[model samples]
Target chain A: MAKIRPVGDRVVVKPAAKEEVTKSGIVIPDTAKEKPQEGTVVAVGSGRLLDNGERAALEVREGDRVLFAKYSGTEFKLDGEEYLVLKESDILAVLS
Target chain B: MAKIRPVGDRVVVKPAAKEEVTKSGIVIPDTAKEKPQEGTVVAVGSGRLLDNGERAALEVREGDRVLFAKYSGTEFKLDGEEYLVLKESDILAVLS
Candidate 1:
């Protein structure tokens, strides 16, 4: 598999699979489902450069489960697998 | 007039009025006009906080003519005047 190194505070995520059924036992059609907001961190870029010329450290590391904002990030496919690239700030929280 | 202080690397811009006529002598109606992408900087927030607890300095200052990304920023009205608030990063270039 090809390795992807995101640029500048960007992160690559492997999105969690979308749920097909609702909590009320209703089956939702594929087109009606919302994009998944949760994912596992696959790769992260070095933190954004500060004015003082130092690179800030990112809080999330590889393999961390994270929640990101809905409708954020760019989607792409690599080696038949899908991934998303977005800024670290767009990641709202890391799941325990 | 009420003063607006943008927060955290956000800038307030007074957008240039939309042009009604094209250089080719064609007139465009209000409904056909694109949002203005040029503006003057009116207010700027203190720079974003770096990891080291220092604030980065913004490149655009008050009164600078600038071009920003279209469809970016939040629009609001104060005292009947319109303004836009967006991150400094959204500002593409400072006009000479």
Candidate 2:
């Protein structure tokens, strides 16, 4: 498997599976599907460079489930698996 | 004037001015204005709540110039001046 280590405050995430059928029995089309906002953190960057030359640590860690903004992050395919690279701030909340 | 003190990791930014003409001397209309990617940090939240129940300090500060992603943050007008409420993560970089 190819390894992908993020740089700076970037985080690698595996998004949750897309829902085929809605609760209302509506089959959403692919083009109409909304962007997934939840994912699992797979990898994290060392830290972001602060103005004072300090490295600010990332807020989320690997294996943590997080909720992010709708349009956040850049998507990539690695080893046939989809992943997202986003900043820690793009993650809205961490699930308990 | 109304005060807008951000909460958590939210920040208030004043965007850079829009350009009426392009470099090639082409006039651009207001409706064709692209979203501003740079701004000045006006106010910031105390800190973000960490998973360990601690507060992680914000990276940016007041009066700092920053670059942010387009389509990020909520926009509002305070005292007739436009401002943006964004998470620290939305801000991509700080200019020295």
Candidate 3:
């Protein structure tokens, strides 16, 4: 698999698949599922360049499970696997 | 007029009106005109908070004519005047 190194505070995440089961055990179709906003950080960029020429450290690290904003990030496929590249700010929280 | 103080690297801008004239002097109607991407800064936030707890100085200041990304920012009206509030990153360049 090719390694992806995001640039400038961007992160590459592999989103978790949306759950297809309902509370009553009904299987929802793919079209009815919402896009997953949760993902695991696969890679992180160095940091965002600050106005003072310093790089702001990223709060999330690789292997961290994170929740990002809905409809954020660019999606792409690498080696038949899907990934998303988004800025650190797009990530709302790091799941414990 | 009520004063608006934007918060957290956000800026309030009064957008320039879109041009209605073509090169050949044809007038475009309001419905056909694209949204203007240029504006004058009316207010600015202190700055974006950095990971180190320092605020990053914004490049655009109040009264600066700037170009910003289209479809960015929230639109609001104050005292019947229209304005846009957008983050500094949404501003593309400062007009000289």
**Residue B62 CA error for candidate 2 (Å)?**
0.7
Tens digit of lDDT per residue, candidate 2, span B1-96? 137789998899887774611221222223322322657889999877766666767878898766566589999987789988999878754544
RMSD of each: 11.9, 11.8, 12.1
Indicate the fraction of true inter-chain contacts that candidate 2 also forms. Answer: 0.00
- TM-score for chain B of each model, two decimals: 0.79, 0.77, 0.77
Top-down TM-score ranking: 2, 1, 3
Error at B87, model 3, angstroms:
0.6
Report the lDDT tens digits of candidate 2 across residue range A1-96.
115456469787887765612322333345645543767898877697665545788989898877776577665544456666687888987876
iRMSD for each candidate structure, in the order shown = 14.1, 13.2, 14.6
Residue ranges of candidate 2 with Cα displaced over 4 Å: A1-96, B19-36
How far is A14's C-alpha from truth in model 3 (Å)?
A: 36
lDDT for each residue of candidate 3 in B21-47, tens digit (9 for 90 to 100) = 122122222332222256778998988
In model 2, the Cα lDDT at residue A63 comes to: 87
